[model samples]
Target: MSRIIRNLVSLALLLTAMSVQAAPSSFDLVGPRLSVAVTRDGSTLPLEWVPNLAEGDRVAIKLDLPAGQSDRFRLVAAFLRGAVDRPPDAWFHDTVSGKTKGGDLSLVVPKGAQQLVLFVLPERGAGRNAIVSAVRKQPGTFVRAVQDLNQAALDRARLDTFLDLLFRIGRQDPDSVNAASQVLTRSLAIKLKTECLQQPPELQAACLTGDRETLLFADTHSSALADTLTGAPVDLAFQLSATPQGGYGSYSSYIGVVRDILRLFGAFQSSQLRFVPALARMGDGRLTLLLNTPLSFAKPASVMVVGLPAIEAAKPPPLQAAAGVPLLCAAPDTVLPVEGAPLVYATRYAHDMVLRVAPDGAAGFDLPVHADARRGGFVLDRALPDRSAGATIDARIAGRWGFTPFDGPRFKLSDPRVNRWTAAPRASLVVGRSNAVTLTGEGAGCIDGITMQRGDAAAQAVSWKQDDANTIVVDVPLDKATPGTVTLTVTARAPAPPVSIVLPALQEVGRIDGVAYAAGDESAVLTGSRLDQVREVRAGKATWRPGALTRAAGADRLTLLPVDPAAAQVLTAGERIVADVTF
Candidate 1:
């Protein structure tokens, strides 16, 4: 096994040496493989995707199998495009029976092997397994592009977020920031009394439930009692605040209240730090998540933050986001400031954009943000005015921002407000015939590509035109949908080198095509073209879902029985593989 893995790794290195950040020399990468061919004899199972090997060089093989099904098959790589004899299984499995699923596996290609295959029937009962999907990860045209697109959305988000934080922080209005220290403390102390109590108290059960002010006092310094938070009651958590030896005096005073903030919610900073739930409020228009990590004399950084509220808030706002339920105001006009002596803020990405807000209140973003500036950072009308104490920065930025793809093209897609990188930016779709939708990104030329689908049917790009430099309108022919699968498109020559766009799944509201059984002993080929096997052929149609059937549902033939004799009569047939619904 070690030798086999080593040989595969060596092959990848060899390919890299021959090419620049790309796939192997002789092979080409193929798209996803959801279909499988299981020979009647079960001697071999060939994937829809064969390793690309029109050969200019040598090759090896890699395979990924469905869970708990690896033992049912053995790996074999083909050579000479079948001109020469194929090699044996590259490595031997401990299980003589290929029935259990193993993770991804690789094999050594023969000196002349160009493609890969699997011998499925190691044993008689082994025909019950399959491969979910496989790609040789070739070094070709789209490899780098796809990798870039993957990170593009993420990069855009960080950059936009960084800009949003910078611009919003510049507008900070400290005067509007009312000090809630006393109010927060009293509220925390009262809330704590209602939800919690001290263990081994000198008083009886209801003793400390009402007089929350005293309970707050008793619990605050309960170092004798404040030892462990392991006593959180159901739906309630335990929190305590302790003042370090040298700390902010008033800030130290409310340490207990702030401690609750540290406990209930996550920190405003990096994922590395953790914070508990702290309650701030949705004051009229502003929705805030407030937690003040006390800045000492040494680290005297103090600034308030206004974050997008939780997806679902405890109470509704006057202006609800989606439903009547109140949501975090779309984009709070507040920028995030680095929490240190010298404030630093940058896009979430490692690179792209960075802004330095000097403590003296001067702020500068990496690029001049002009509203109509194409290919520039988040657009602003004019260069920002330097801000000072309590500046009220309303960074009203919007949409899914992303970075540029690597080594691909000069084109970039940002400002999700108008052109988002997501598949379903519209958030809704209708199925039956075809549906038209727009894709947002930055590219040089007219869009010449699209990918779409509804239910079992796939969609094709019927017509497309460049809406502008940043937007392209593409029409897709959608099929009648039950639940539309995610539709993706690879638009060639958008900004030039061609880019792929994955729209959100066009969620279709339609009927379910469940596999219902007829009464009696029966064996029939399932309706679909390429199905291997299904775990349960619905015994009775009792609220079944697609998930009820596992991935190995590639087998064409299925055998089923009725859950009840009455249901048997309702279904009447042995195997109703095909549906009788009107199209």
Candidate 2:
């Protein structure tokens, strides 16, 4: 053979080998059928029907090898404790040499092992280190393989149940169809549009069977659905209409239509069911986890957020999962009762929602939170100091299928700091009207105390609400006020001095007695008692404020522009437009 021919042959062989390696693994072809059985109350029973197993349970691994492949292959079992990167030998592992066809191998589940991974490799290089190294090199591959297997197994059970219901309906059982209706409604976490449900009783069913089915089903090729399913949950802005269609005709046909629709939904579920986690910063500075999962058909009964530290990084500061506490700033009084770190939330059938966690003050955690393989539980982390800043923490999201490493958002260790408060009084004290006062500054949303008083008398009644991040609106009722100077004081989240504003007697406040406007003129004149106190005036829908003021004989005069000309025209049309005068 010539040298050139040999080189060509070698290049062809190299490409073939590369292609083989790059080809994706088919979960079915690499067949080593396995089943788990747990020992409960001294009786070892097969758990083929069980969807999940808890940590620290003693289990037997039943394996069945592929045809003509046995003695050369060995099964390596990795009981995963947490979604953290570790050395090949750092994780717990057990092996069963494929000496015989396939037999039961017994092993105890380690504490905190959220999942178990099995690798069937050739015995020659299948040492513990080699197997772990191969598993670690492609962690996502190993995890996803098991995750897919679990999801498929779950889907199989669901398919069987659905098929059984369909078979009963075929047997002329009308009640079976009604029973399946509830199941079909819960098949997807996404909600139907309000319009679809708002139809009259007779048209309700027709509405769902109409072209409006897209309101509930998103388009299979929609980029929005693809994007939403790929990453953390985002605020869905577009309408959903993918993948499922509304079935027309008889009510029984609707059942078959839903069955087909659910089939498509299941395929979507299999493709997009990612158990990864994403972090979001809530409005009030609280960090939240948005786990990307909850299959359209099989939503999780509960979710857990596990905090794990980096293997090589500095020791993580103490942290806590504030379970059952409401993030007042972000969600206000919505009490989210979570378990602990991994903070477990009993969220059944929730496709995506914000989960808030806080550190526990009492019985805090330590570094290196892990799922214990032997002890059968988790070792959580501790709470950081109140002033701790720039501290980093790692997190993972765990569901029924499995857990995945998640990158959490950076958060501050303390509440928002307020430097000062500035008050912009929007209204004056009128004897029989409500006054609005606007306060703007840092920590404006944290107003807990506010009061109004006349001289040194008792505090007057006032109500205030945070309008935004740096603004607050306070309503002061002057229905029972006597003529006197009223002082307003506000206390907020910050420990600074209380901000105060003073107002003159209610009788001294200005009033708009009459508003004068000329046809086609841009400005309007207001004549009223104490006109100097009047800051703004409204004629119909148009707002007019004094720009230049002049005092005439026994009267105060001001030039004001009608900001809206169209509304000013309504005034010229003799519309009974009310004049609103405010300080």
Candidate 3:
């Protein structure tokens, strides 16, 4: 044989091998054969739909369950007409006949349909994830997506048909759709249930829509679970103290959502959902005022924001015509510009919307935060304009219209929140006599582990517990400390796209030199160059906190004051030494 012929044959074989390798693992087998090949344990599922019903969009279902797992589980699907209501029976394969195209391998539906069904059947291991690949490619599969606030595009990252949200105050303007549109955006149309202008104070978020089959559900105004967090028995105090702007990192929005979920489980629950400030100005010519939440809301007509009489009484910031760039700031209290102002309004309450993520949160989009597979979560990092470290405002919601606030939080033409992140991230460590080491701002999602090695001293297993998701307290053994400084290190974990950050070794603080004082003592003076910090101090049987410290002589003389008088009780000499210092 000629060498040319041999080379040609080898090239042909290589091409054939590559093509076979490129074929997708799953395939569609839709024809007359109802009992086709089980196809490697139902790894991939193919489906189709044609508009055959009366007055709604067409629907289809595909399943890819493990072969042996669901031997008796037939494909059954159902939907929720409202937030809390659903039909008793599910539509089976018989309800909707299926037809597979002969050679092309496609499931064909009937004709002239108007209604569609999004099955809420997680138990079936079917629906969206099982079929979105083909569905997104199909001509008209009704993609489950979220439209951008700019209305320029839709985000389909998570293929869910709906999300739970709250209803806030609304407004009336030529471009009012932009406000609610901030939270209400999806590739598919949505019906938001929000507060209308029918009454003075809109307290509820349950207004009936015209469609008897469709129900709008949302949490009411007092939805914040702040009270529940205060007495949170769990060591989730790290989650409680975290500020929304500084602690949560990219998943700040997602953490708030998870915190709200924890709130529902906490002993005390509230109907109030937390609200964030949103600025929508697409550059048209009008301004629309709408309160924003991370959750989604629909009902454009029902969403309205009416400032209480107190908003006007606060002497809010004045509205200046085209005053620099309209900057939105989040203040502790609610304030707003006068009518005809082009700003947004939102009040600040101690919502604790911010949360601590693992140190590896930066890579959360891709890999697991830890090598041990101990945790998993996602981050919703919404970029904003000017992070002043004091406030945050996402301007993507800013449309072309002018937003006029009747009464709400103040919005100026010059507030800042973009650079806030530049100086936002900081690391802190508080040490104490109890040998408790508190890690602050250590991780992005969750603090996974801590190790302290004093020179050659065996990498001691310091027992620790999470004060919150972002903070952890590693209680070193009483014998671990000496009179000199020591080096300590930690590793934090966030969700993937995998990120792990190791903080610089923290230098230890030397022993405190002070007059002995009982835990019940109100104050104690220490003359030393080293001061140990602690989050909690226990004296006698009660919990006491060390208050602000005052130093004088060459920064050596220090005074510690106990703030909790209730914890003051007669004690023994054993409690006369220094207690933990609360930061």
lDDT of each prediction vs. the true structure? 0.28, 0.41, 0.27
Q: In candidate 1, which residue ranges exceed 4 Å CA deviation?
A: 1-191, 195-241, 245-363, 366-418, 421-583
Positional deviation of 185 in candidate 2, in angstroms?
Answer: 12
Q: After superposition, how far is residue 534 of candidate 3 from its true place, in Å?
A: 21
The lDDT of model 2 is 0.41
Error of 1 at 16 (Å): 89
lDDT tens readout by residue for model 2, 1-583:
6999999999999999998765422112112345555564464434431224555456676545556764544455676544454423545455554554444567666555566654444455335565565556555444433443333322222222333433444356443343332333223212233453454444443443333222222222333543344322222211211211111000110112222222332332222121221111111112122222331222311111111111111111112333322222211231222211111111111111222234434332222333221121223333333442221122222222111112222122212233246665644565544567676665553356788887778986588876655566778777566777778887654444577778765665455557777777878888755665677887657888776766556355767776676777666645466777787
User: Ranking by lDDT, best first?
Assistant: 2, 1, 3
Models, CA RMSD each? 34.8, 19.8, 27.2
Q: Over the stretch 427-527, how does candidate 3's per-residue lDDT look in tens digits?
A: 42323233555554423222235556654566654576645423456665534344433345544332212222222233455554544455546765554
* Cand. 3 TM to true fold: 0.21
Q: How does model 3 fare in lDDT?
A: 0.27
Each candidate structure's count of clashing pairs:
60, 24, 82
Which ten residues in a row are the worst by lDDT in model 1?
Answer: 337-346
The residue ranges of model 2 lying beyond 4 angstroms of the native Cα positions read 1-384, 388-404, 408-433, 448-461, 487-583
Off by over 4 Å in 3: 1-433, 440-442, 446-448, 463-473, 492-583
